[model samples]
Target: MEYFIQQLINGLTLGGIYALIALGYTMVYGIIQLINFAHGEFFAAGGYMGVILLSFLSANGYLATYPWLCLSGAIILSMAYCSLLATGVEKIAYKPLRKSSRLSVLLSALGMSIFIQNGLMLTQGVYDKAYPTIFSQGGFDFGNIKVSYMQIVMLLITILLLILLNLLVFKTRIGKAMRATAQDKTMSSLVGIKSDRIISLTFIIGASLAAAAGIMVGMYYGSVGYTMGFVPGIKAFAAAVLGGIGNITGAMIGGFLIGMIEIFGAGYISSEYKDVFAFIILIGVLYFMPTGIMGENIDDTRV
Candidate 1:
């Protein structure tokens, strides 16, 4: 039971990160029906940005005196940076192909992914940059279970972000506009909603979430790499699909499920087969529920 609890906590932590990343996938697909293969690059960019900003703080002696403040500033700045980056990617790569075939848009997204990945490698180098040790060292003990401060922090941020997102989607006027635009772009435009703006906003929001996930992952793992986003990105995409691709709630649930499966599979079976275990579960679930665990009655257009 102690071992099970340990793995469960680990799973939730990993799941939260994946949920953050997966939300990006679901939101974008909900709005535009695009898979957005380049979305992962935003995560990578956020990790790099977080490391860069935090390192600057450390160098300037700011982090030592005000660790939490510095960390918060880094996260906000990274999210903003990624939001701007997503906007640029949307305007440059996706906007022009809005009326084009799905294949063209998909190819463009793939090209953008390659382009961004290579750009990161060129600019940040292929080496893994170590995150400054701050919260990485501390943890709390509950009986035989051990939990890190990083895990607590990560979970709080994840839950907070998720709540804020739910409120944004279900409560705000902008969110209403987004939902309307998703449901019927032409009709929404005719009804005075700007579909283009909503689409851009969707991209911005998704990128911001991915950015947060990137920072959390870096803090948890103690390092960041230029190539770090690819696998997690793919897994998050699987989570999105598993949860019903375009459904927000589904994405979150799918992410947690995938994370739990990976952790348990690693704990009981072998670490070497962790990734395979995640995919296998995804396949099994899809085989039984083609529309995903939460895909039922979810309009693809509603966020």
Candidate 2:
């Protein structure tokens, strides 16, 4: 029971990370139909940006005593950087192909992904950098089950963000516009909605969320690498698909499910192949329910 509880906590935390990143994929797909393959790189960019900001603060004596303030600053900076990066990608890489063929946009997305990856490698190097520990060392224990403060924090962050996203998508005017645009770009434009603006906003929101996830992962793991986004990115993409692409709620559920599967499969099956577990589940899901858990909603077809 203790082992089970411990693993559950770990899985939830991991799922939270995947869900946040997966939201980016789903949102982009929901609004523009473009996969935004470079999104994973955006996640990496956020982590690297946080690391740089934290290092600067530490070196400047800004974080010498006010650790919380430094941490807050890093988070804010990381989010901001991610928002700009996302908006820039849309304006530069994707906007040009908005009227082009789907294949053209997809190819551009792939190229953008490679470009960002190599750009980071050249700038930050290929080695892993140690991440600064922001949270105090400790964990709540119960009957041999231990839950780290970082895990709790990650879960809370994920929930808070999820709530915020839900409200934004369901309760706001912009959210309605996004949905409308998703349903039919031509109709949205005819109804006085600027599809381009909605699409850009979608990218911004998605990128910012992914950035938060990246920063949280770096802090939890104590280190980060340029390529860290590759596996996680793929997994998050799978989670989006598993939950049903373009479905926000489905993305959240799928992320948690994937997390549980990966962690439990590692514990019960083989740790060596734990990572492959997500893909296996993905294949099974696709084979049986290609529309995914929520079923693809034609109301909001991918752009």
Candidate 3:
């Protein structure tokens, strides 16, 4: 029982990370109908940015003196860097092909992904960067189960972000415009909503979320690599699809489910096949409930 509880806690924390990355996938797909394959590269870029920022702080002795502030600064700077990179990618690679065939856009996205990955490798070098041991010391324990303060912090951050995102999409006028554009871009444009601008904002927000997720994962693991985003990105895509691609709520549920499945399967079954559970769930979800938990259709997805 205690072991089960421990796995549950671990699952939720992992799920939160997956959920954050999945939001980027779902939001971009919901708005544009184009899967931004380069989105994962954005995650990698953010991790690298965080590493650089943290390294700078550590070199200057500020990381030791003001740990939280340094962490916050790293997150902000990394997010900003990724957001700008995504924006540029959108403007350069995707914007011109907005009216092109779906296959063309998909090819472009893949091409962009390749470019980003190689660029990161060439610039940052192919190496694993370790985070400074800022939160390595303290936590609370229960029975035979141990939980870290960082896990609690990650959980709270995920919950807060989810709530704010829900309110943003459901309450704001811009959100309504986003929904409107998602339903019918041409019609939304006719109704005086700027579809282009809405789409750009969607990319920006999604990229920012991805970057934030990248920072959290780096902090939790205490290390990151240029290739780190690929597996997690694939898992996040699976989570979005499992919950219902394009459905925000479904993506969140799917993320948690994936996280739990992976952790518990590893705990009770075999650790070597831990990564297989998320894909199995994805296949199960796809084979059984095609529309996802709450999805309507491809074109009618909400923010």
Give the TM-scores of the predictions, in the order they appear: 0.98, 0.95, 0.96
lDDT of each: 0.92, 0.87, 0.87
Candidate 1 residue pairs in clash (backbone atoms < 3 Å): none
On TM-score, the leading prediction is: 1
**Clashing residue pairs, backbone N/CA/C < 3 A, model 3:** none
For model 2, how does the per-residue alpha-carbon lDDT over 1-303 read when each residue is reduced to its tens digit? 778888898899999999999999998998877787998988999889878887788788777789778877788789999999989988999998889998999899899888988898999998987776656368898879888888888899899999999999999998899899988899999999998899899999999998999888888888778998888898999899999898899889989989999999998899899878878888898898887887575454742
Off by over 4 Å in 2: 298-303
| Model 1: CA > 4 A from native | 297-300
